[model samples]
Target: MGTFGRRLLLAVDAKGYGGADAVTQRQLQEAIRRLLSEAAAASGLEWERWETQVGGDSVFAVLPEGASEPDLVDTFMRHLDAGLRAFNHGRVRAAWLRLRAVVHFGSASPGAIGFVGRAPVEVGRMLDSAALKAALAAAPDACLALAVSPTVFNDVISDAYTTIRAQEFREVVVAEKEHTGRAWIRVPGYDARALDLGVPSGAGREGATGGGEVPDVRPPSAPTAPGDTVVQVINGTVHAPGSVFGISK
Candidate 1:
């Protein structure tokens, strides 16, 4: 027997982070744990329990009923985002984590296998699939901010911020240390080196090793690419940077 409800499973990892493999992995794991605990308390969600897996780099938990409201999910997302930023600020430059977070909601069986439900394992798998595609399309230094399944997107996401959807996985070349492998995704006008090495040239595109793993080194380019600029909108109208970027609550 399985419960029929919107079960959410979130699994997160960073892209192109450069730090000790073990330490960086641990940091991500610990951050998730802390975030879950804090969010549960603040959101008043009845989180049953959580488990640390894969050397503290990943986690899984159950959300209490009534925690799936769109407004509440959005609020929780903002909270998680803020908490992650704070966690990175305390780490070294090389240790900063730009994460790929995937959230999946569906029916789940809490107990051991054999129950017919979308359990955390399946939800986590979906997130990983989405993250892999997003990460591959992302610039080397670019990390996926967050990903929500259609269930969450349609049900929980507010229609405020427009989502930039990347196409499904498309293979590409990745240059890495002592080896080269085929990667995927095509982010138009993306420059990995510019973001990672402060170089204008976009080179050495590669799949990310686990969080905090060192990437292949390349000579830094001379020129610096201009930052990507975009228009900010508010209340159904475009706003100035001061009004948008600097708007305070």
Candidate 2:
């Protein structure tokens, strides 16, 4: 039994894992371990000691007590992307590994089998969200896509506590199952300036992934089809491009 408190939550899932054969799935399981190990080590984290729950295609981790909030978001994330690039560098297109990650801060308690709490469940929901899945579907060249929960974004990302700029993340609402919440999406090393959103030809869409002519730096003015997401832009509301802004909702 573990005490419940504020802890750093992190999750990573391999893309298109189900379609692969058994050999490929085994390789991916190894890759998941390597990805987390290499990234954590690069970020100066002792991942072995972190409370972790591993699945066939994903890994859920809870940083040990007193974990550094800033490092997980900034350093760990940066290295995760870097590790992904390294893993896919020489592999064939079909053998390459792509990942989706979500970071959040929430209250949790360890249980007999795995983490038993809302935070872990929330992270899972966000991970399964169509908005996040569409993020990867939209960016064919990106190796990894990441989303931070509202708490993490507001407390750490929005406050510039990490090196990643707030504007780099596109704000979107994620509705998966019964859990609906806000999330910020980012694809490292890929340019989303010309994303091909799967929006209708001429629907009543303000800012959607439709028609493939839109970018993610803009805010989601009107809701689009279910599972579609739009980014929130500063609209040049601030004078400086690097200046930080707050989440309105």
Candidate 3:
């Protein structure tokens, strides 16, 4: 809320994978719900508008005026990432459970009178289709990726990471091009070192300065009623009672 018109458009998405079978069923709904609740709490920033769409796996929030900007983004991501891991502990397959996150930053503003334009929607679409999946594959641990728009790239990509080559994706290029429509430069404190890639708070894991191990994965179980999966989750681990049945048979 400074005289500066700069704002960050953060788009995020998460997915669950690998169970006895698609039907054996991981606690997808419960995981997503906890993700949203934790993100809202973690950000501690108001939203111009926030909503859950594209099923329950994804949630969108627009940072309101006076939000911490880059710092808020880092906080929100760390909060959600830690929450998911904590949510997965103690289950029969807890070690195998993981989540993927993709965040894109851009110049954004609410449509006059409060309608969302193509801005947030386009980012969400990219996240849904590619970035989210890529994060899962590229992330060494169940890591979170916070991508900066080219508009702010020079500001955030450190001299070290900037000189180093990074994988290229057409979607990333396109989004960056779109964001340059408005004149802007990177803001301070928006560099790669600022990214909090470590584990979540109080999760009992070591600091995430370096990446962690990649857990083993099994296929999802075959089809079963959602109601039949009695998801009991505490401290981030989901417990599905044995009667829940349909596990990868």
Candidate 4:
């Protein structure tokens, strides 16, 4: 059973999880948990208090509505980025951890299984978005890429509510079956516009050129387990399996 409520959504996924061998894949799993816990601690959110759904190389966390949204974007991101860099430091190339993360807000139901609604689905969409992947890929130095939903961007980050530097966020349009929205992408500590991710400087919010060559956003599909829900990537009305390093529910 599930109850509907306004919830704060957080989704994160490993950057290159599938290519890793068995042991390294396990390590990635551990690192994501630790990094998330640490970043949550640094940002003053209690990880244990969060309703988190964990699975193949990714996580969906539904935070309390009162949790500070601004800090999640700015402080949470900075700490997570730093934590990943530290994890990568002095570590073997095979064990290094990197992530693509997204934050959005909407009505969703917290159920016995996991969040069930368009909100959780949109969180997945935002995390799987092409712009978020490109920003992280374009800046190899960055250990994390963040995508902010239009609701969060408009209500908080864009209006000087946080220190995320609004100018650093590049708006991008993401469209998938039955879903479409404008999301802002950024890599912490790098030149955001240098990646050139749409959002015309002069055209206001009307037209968004996908900047550079938009990568093939066909996300990688993972093998299913006995007790897991898999969210596959769609390639024009057909589900394409394992197209890129990607996501699963």
Best by lDDT: 4
After superposition, candidate 1 runs with Cα above 4 Å error: 1-5, 14-24, 46-55, 113-116, 119-122, 130-144, 158-249
What is the TM-score ranking, best to worst? Answer: 4, 2, 1, 3
Backbone clash count, each prediction separately: 0, 3, 14, 0
Ranking the candidates on lDDT from highest down gives: 4, 2, 1, 3
- Stretches of model 2 off by over 4 angstroms after superposition: 191-194, 197-249
Clashing pairs in 4: none
- Worst 10-residue lDDT window for candidate 3 reads 225-234
lDDT of each: 0.41, 0.67, 0.37, 0.70
When summed lDDT is taken over every stretch of 10 residues in candidate 4, the lowest stretch is: 222-231
What TM-score would each prediction reach against the true structure? 0.51, 0.77, 0.47, 0.78
Residue 130 Cα positional deviation in candidate 1, in Å, after optimal superposition: 5.8
Clash pairs detected, candidate 1: none
Best by TM-score: 4
The residue-by-residue lDDT of candidate 2 on 40-131, one tens digit each, is 88777787777666667877777877788788888988887787788788777777788888888888775654566677777776676666
State, as a TM-score between 0 and 1, how close model 2 is to the true structure.
0.77
In angstroms, the error of model 3 at 92 is 5.4
Q: Which lDDT tens digits does candidate 4 get at residues 1-249?
A: 567688787888888888899998887899898999999999998777887767668887878769889889888888899889988998776667879898988888744445566767777777876667777888877888888877787778767789866777766656666665567777887876566443334433233433333333332441111111111222364111121123222
Return model 2's CA RMSD, one decimal: 10.5
